[model samples]
Target chain A: MGRTSDAREKILGAAHSLIELRGYSALGVAEICRTAGVPKGSFYYFFESKEALALAVIDDQWATQRSDWTRVLKSDAQPLQRLRQLFEETEAEQLAGQQNCGTVSGCLFGNLTLEMSNQTEAVRTRLQEIFDAQVDMVDTVITEALARGEVTVSDTRAAARSVVAQLEGQVLFAKLYNNASQLGALWTNCLALLGADSPHVPTAA
Target chain B: MGRTSDAREKILGAAHSLIELRGYSALGVAEICRTAGVPKGSFYYFFESKEALALAVIDDQWATQRSDWTRVLKSDAQPLQRLRQLFEETEAEQLAGQQNCGTVSGCLFGNLTLEMSNQTEAVRTRLQEIFDAQVDMVDTVITEALARGEVTVSDTRAAARSVVAQLEGQVLFAKLYNNASQLGALWTNCLALLGADSPHVPTAA
Candidate 1:
């Protein structure tokens, strides 16, 4: 029983890594099994099919990511400071890991939404819910910053979406160049745009 | 001679449509031949290999896009206004087309950067050159805007990179959602960040 459970964990770990590397659409069950050092038969014993395994992987990654982001966003620091720290930490993680998925793989939920969500409404709806929740989380933090006059924007919701969009773009750029400098550049630009040191110059130009 | 030329055009057209609908990696020569109503022999006659055909498709599409964006950006209007118009027209085009490759299939250049470019330095260098040229174009336009006092930024180079990054993110989002609305949303958000007037804000979010 112990050995079988260990193999199952190993298979999941391998699938998660491969999916991150090549994308969920490009990965195959056989490849995951091989990478996990498990027999093909063992794959079936653990997961019903490749899609099932992928869904499982998505769920696992989503939970971990939410926990990490929540911890950072809810820290004792000021909301604006917390947001900046979140982005800074994210930039550092991407730099150190040479991986852009967690920060930018365009949201694994967003990715699955494009790949299989249309084919399966259940998946589509689930991903939408998750994404909407994430947007709301950022919205709350940004709103707090606004109330405190730490950040100023014409529209808080739109600003939140732009922040997400910019982060997503930086991730894609990082993946394209296989470097994290673009991510750092994005953080620096975003900070300047929102920094308290700079007065909100609505008509600076 | 006429019949042979017609057949070749059909093959290329079919290959382009299929690649945009599915994906380059998921498509096969046999499928392209079938869709085009041409035989396997004729496909070989028209193109040396799948890679050759893909490269041809890329070249054709890139030329068309270059002309389209250049015309929009170089219009007889304010530099910032012209940039906003370009984005508006792009939003319209995305909504009007079916199975569009512009945002969905991704910038063929950006997509190839993620896939083939990593394996082949030749392809990588070609994509880099294309992207660098794109940045230069954007920089010129943005710098013009800055000179006109239409927009302000601490770093023009980083802002240029950010614009390209946002465009890439929009494409990925469009492809994932299979909805042009997301592209429009991204465009509107971008315009707001650049301090342009956008009529796309939802009445209720």
Candidate 2:
């Protein structure tokens, strides 16, 4: 049982990095098995198919990201400051990815969503749930900001969508431009969207 | 000469539809040749390789999209109104795609950027060029808006990036949710980003 679980994790980790770097359609089961150093039969034993493995990858990546989000968002910082910290951490993460891979990999969810959303219903719906959850988290933060007079906005939901969408777009630009500095504007534009009066300097990790 | 040009155009047209619907990695040369009704030899005769054909697709699709952008942006409409028209037109296009394929295909450039940016230099640089052109066009419109007092922004270039980024993100969401209506807020958020005073209804086509 221990080895079985270990093999499953190895396979998932391999798929995650491959998909992160090269995208969904380009990588196949054979490469994934070879990368994980697991037998092909073991892969089928763990996952019904490649699509199933991808769904698990999405679920696992989201769980990992959600933990980080919950930590930053639940901190005692002010709502606007919390938002800034979130983006700053994102920048740091992208820089780390660049250090490892020579270019920023952007968001796994955003990358997978764009590549597979139209091609597969299961992946698309799963990604929608992830994004919806993200919006909910952001909406909660925005509502708190409104209560504390940290920001002003007529519609919190639309504002949340804008914040999330802007971040995704910035990451996409970062990937396209191969420049992590392009992501610097995410926090400022986010503050402007939320009607924050004063800009906060990005906190270094 | 005429027959050679026709074969090249036919191959490009087939690739355009396939890549737009499926993506770059999933579609292969043989399928494209079959779809174009051209011989394998003919495909290579016109283009150097699959990557070259994809480059042509990017160039061709951008040419198609830029024409629409120019028509809307260069009209007699006010700057803010023109921007709204652009997003409205984008929404209509996504809806049309959804009607055809039961899913929003999003921006072809964006989709390709996420999938192939890390894998291939030619495609990544081509997409970056396309995005730069788009930002330039938006910057010009924003400059006009600034001159006319229709909008106020400190940095028009950053503002243009924000506009372009927000639209890309919204289309991504539309694709993720498989609901074109998710893109409805693009114009409103864009107006807010530009510091425009009020929302402009999308102009009739």
Candidate 3:
């Protein structure tokens, strides 16, 4: 049982890394098996197919990400400040290992939306729900801030969508330019949109 | 010579359509030939390989898009109104298509950025230049609005990036949801950010 679980984790981890770097279409089962250091036969033992493996990777990543973000959103800090901290932490994660972490490879969810949304309804619906959840989280933060008079916006949903959009756009730009600094600019602009000062300062760690 | 040129254009047109629908990686050369109604052998006669064909498609699309955007930006209309018109036109084009347009397919440049930006400096630099040009154009429009006191913002660059980011994000969302209506909401929210109203209304062709 222990060995089976370990092999499953290894496959998921390898798929995450490969998809992040090379994208979904470019990743192959052989590459996943080789990277996981597992036998090809073991791959099918864990996953029904390559598409199944990709779905697993998506679910794993989204689950962890949702928890991490939910914790930040529910923190004791002020709503606006908490949001800033969330982006800051994301930046820190991207910078970890000298890599631009903040979904700069583009949201694995967003990437799947573009690639598989039309071809596969299962992938499409799953991605849309994930994105809708993300947008909802941002809307909650924005609404809380609005109710507290911490921020002022005529429309909360639009503001939330704008925030998500900017973040998504920055990730796309960062992936294209290979520079995380553009993300900093995006963060600053987003703050300004909310009528707040830029809270993101590059940290040494 | 004219026949050869016609074949080349047909091939490019078909490739563009395929890439927009399915993306570059999923698109096969033989499929492009079939769509173009050209012999499979003729595909190699015009292009050395898929990569070469892709490059040609990118260049052609970029040129046409640049011209289309430039026409809207340079029109003798109110700067802010011109910007609104740009989005309106884009939304219309997206609505007209059966699937999300190229820019929403994540921008051919952005899609390539994810797939090849890390692997090839030549493609990376070229894509960066393309994006930068887009930013510069938006900057010009925003700067003009600022100069005319049409919009209120302390940082024009941030405003410009925010606008572009929202557009890119809307593209992704529209693609994911398979609904262009989200784009209308996005545009409405963006116009609100600029203290304007949504200009998109039902119109006849």
Candidate 4:
């Protein structure tokens, strides 16, 4: 049982890294198994197909990211500050990824959304739900900021979508230039998007 | 001579559509050749490698989009209105793509940026140049807007990056949801990012 579980994790980890560094369509199960140091048979035992494994990878990354998002967005900090924290932490995470991998990997979900969404209905629906949930979280924060008279927006949901869309776009730049600092604009950009006042200097991480 | 030129154009057209529909790595020369209805020998005659072919595709697409961008961004229209026209036209283009292909094939450059940036230096350098040119064009408009006091931005270049970045982000959503309307927020988001006043209704397209 221990050995079987170990093989499963090894395969998942290998798929995750490969998909992160490259992308979904370019991968093969044999290579994934080879990288995982497990036999090909173990892959079939774990994931029914490469698409299934890609879905699993998406699920796992979202689980980790969602936890991070909830922690920051739900904290007791003022709603505006919470949003700032989200941007700062996002930049930090991308920077950390750059240091580890020699390139900023951007958001895995955003990456997969562009590369896989049109090709697979299953991936498309899953990504839509994930993004919907992200917008929901950001919308809640914007509503809070609106109530406190800290921001003004005619439509909170649309504001949140713009903010999240801006983040994804900036992250795309970060990955293209291999410079994580491109994301530093998100804080000010978000404030502007929401019609909030210019930001205070973010508290240092 | 005319027949030979036709064959080359055929290969280029087929590769462009295939890459736009799928992506770079998942394609093979043989499949592209078959789709092009050209002999594999013809592909070798026109392109040196798959990467070289991708560069040609990138160049061809950019040439067309640059013309469109220049026409809109350099027009005598009010500076901010030019930006609004850019967004409206972008959404229209995506909508047209969805109607033709049953999918909102996104900015071909952005699709490649997320999927191909880290994998190939030649492709990466080419994409970087393309995006830099995009920012430069947008910077010119933002600078014009700032001069007129129509938009307020601390740094016009950074502001241009934010605006372009927002467009890229929103386009990513439009593609994922297969809905071009996701891009309608771009003009408003751009105004917010530039610290401009709430918009007057954009003149009808």
Candidate 5:
């Protein structure tokens, strides 16, 4: 049982890294097993299919990200300040990723959304839920800001979606340019998207 | 000679559609040729490699999209109005895409950026140039709006990048939800990004 779980963890770790580096379509089961240093049989023992493995990767990555997001977004910082920190940490994470891998791998979920969402129903439904939850989290922050009268937007839900969309969009640029600094705009842009008044501009920094 | 060029066009057409449908990595020369109704020999004759074919498709797609953007952006319409028109056209185009295909395919450049940018330097540089040009065009419009006292943004270039970023972000959602209506918030969002007054809100509709 110990060795069996080790093989499963190995496969998951390898698959996650490969997926981040090369995307979903370009990867093959043989290649994944080779990268994991596991036998093909072990792969089958762990994942019934590549798609199932991808679902596992999505779940695994989101599990960690959701925890980080919850901690930062649900922190005691002011609502806007929390949003600002999210972008700061996002930029830092992408920067760290570039330094480690020599290229910004971009958001794994965003990459999968573009590459596999159209082709697979399971991936699509899962990505949709993940993004929905992300927006829901941001919505909670924006609602807090709204109640405090820190923002001007009346539709907090749409505002949250727009904020997440901007992050996804700028992250696309960061990936395209291989420059994590491209994401620095997210905080300022987020402020604009939420229609916050100039009084909060200095606090944003 | 005529037959050779015909085969090239067929391959390009098929590859474009297939790339739009299933993405680049999932496709192979054999499948592209089969879909194009061309002999594999013809593919070799016209293109040196799959990468070359992809470049051709990128150029072809950009040429058409660039023309459309130039026409709308450089037109005689008021600057803000042109931006509004651009978003409207984008929404219509996405909706039309959904009608034609069962799913929304999102932006080709965006899809490619997230999927291939980290893996291929060639694709990365090409997509960068494309997005740079896109931001440049939007910058011109935003600058015009600024001069007319129509928008309040102090940094037209950053604002332009933000606008395009918002478009890409919203389009990602559109594709994820497979619902074009998700793009409807673009005009309002764009206005907010520009710090425009409430005056343009009526015109945005």
Candidate 6:
């Protein structure tokens, strides 16, 4: 049982890494199996199909990210400080990935959403849930900041969504330019969106 | 000569549509040829390969978009109004695509950037060029706004990039959720980014 579970973890890890390096449709099961050092039989034993594997990968990635982000949001620091830390860590991670791969690979959720959302319903729906959950988390953080008078935004929901979108867009740009430095403005621009750095008029939420 | 030109246009049109519906990596030359109603021989005659075809597609798409955006930026309205109109038109266009396809497809250049940037050098370089040209256009528009005293920002370049990133991120979310309405916030958020609705400090340019 232990060996079987170990094989499953290995396959998932390999699948995630390969799909990260390449787009979803461009990778094949054979390559994943080879990279995992698992035979074809073991691959199917763990994942019913490639799509099944992808679903698991999405869940796994989102679970890890959610925990990490939740930890940041739940931290004792000021909400604004926590938000800045989140984006700063994001930049550092991308920079590190660029160092390893010679180019920044954008967020897996965003990448998968763009690549597979239109083509696969299951994946698309799951990606949407992941994104919505992420936005909700941000919304909660913003709401907390507002309660504390740490940030001033007319619309917390819009502010949260815009912040997430800007980060994703910056990551996309960073990846497109093949320069992790393109994300240098992410933190500052996000703050601007939240009305953290300046006074803002209250608009209809 | 006219027949050859017609065939080329058909191929380019089909390739663009297929790619927009699917993605860069998911579509194959054979499928493109079938959709275009062109033969394999004709496809080869017109474009050297799929990569070459993709380059042409990028150029063709950018040229069309550039003309439209230039007209918007050059319009007789206030610079800020022109910017608002640009974003409104974007949302309208995206909604139209969603109406036709039942899913929001986001920006083609951005979708391609997320899908192909790390995978293909030729496509990635072209995407970077396309994105840079877009930012330059936005920068020009913002500069014109500054000269006219319609908006205030410290760094026109950073402002331009942030606006573009926010819009792209909104589109990505719209597509992810299969909800064209996700872009509803694009215009408002964009105004906020430009400091149009609020006075902004001039940061380091």
- Please give the DockQ score of every candidate, comma-separated: 0.30, 0.45, 0.36, 0.51, 0.58, 0.46
Candidate 1 lDDT by residue in tens digits, A1-205: 9989988888989987775555565677888999999988999998888877877787787788889889988888888777767777777766766653432233455445444543455555566566666667777887887788876565667566556656766766665566666676554444433333344533112
lDDT, candidate 6, at A107? 95
Docking class of 3: acceptable
How would the candidate models be sorted by DockQ, starting from the highest?
A: 5, 4, 6, 2, 3, 1
Model 4 C-alpha lDDT versus the unseen true structure: 0.89
TM-score of 2: 0.94
Residue A183 in model 1: lDDT: 71
Please give each candidate's TM-score: 0.83, 0.94, 0.88, 0.97, 0.97, 0.93
Model 5 per-residue lDDT tens digits across residues A1-205: 9999998999999999999999999999999989989998999988989999999999999999999999999999999999989999999999999999999899999999999999999999999999999999999999999899888786888899999999999998888888999898898788877878664452112
Scored against the native two-chain complex, candidate 3 gets a DockQ of: 0.36
Q: Report model 3's TM-score to 2 decimal places.
A: 0.88
Q: iRMSD (Å) of candidate 3?
A: 7.2
Model 4, B3-76: lDDT tens digits are: 89999889989999998888887899999999999999999888999999999999999999999999999999
lDDT of 3 at A174: 65
Query: Where does candidate 2 clash, by residue pair?
Result: none
A172: Cα error in model 2, Å: 0.3
**Tens digit per residue, CA lDDT, model 6, A11-67:** 999998888888888888999999999888998898888999999999999999999
Q: What is the C-alpha lDDT of each candidate?
A: 0.64, 0.86, 0.71, 0.89, 0.91, 0.82
Per-residue CA lDDT of model 2 for A1-205, tens digit only, reads 9999999999999999999989989989989999999998899999998899999999999999999999998889988888989999999999888989998898999999888887788888899899998999998999999898877777788789889998999999999988888888888688667766563432110
Query: Tens digits of per-residue lDDT for model 2 on B14-72?
Result: 99888878889999899999999989899889998899999999999999999999998
Superposition error at A44 for model 4 (Å): 0.3
List, residue by residue over B45-73, the lDDT tens digit for candidate 1: 87888878877776777788778878877
lDDT of 5 by residue, B138-202 (tens): 99999999899978776888899989999999999999999999899999889888878764353
Stretches of candidate 6 exceeding 4 Å from the true structure: A197-205, B198-205
Predicted candidate 3 versus true structure: per-residue lDDT over A101-194, tens digit per residue:
4334656776666666666667777887788888799889888887887665666776777677667777777667665666665555555456
Per-residue C-alpha lDDT of model 4 across residues A2-99, encoded as one tens digit per residue: 99999999999999999889988899999999999999999999888888998888898889989999999999999999998999999999999999
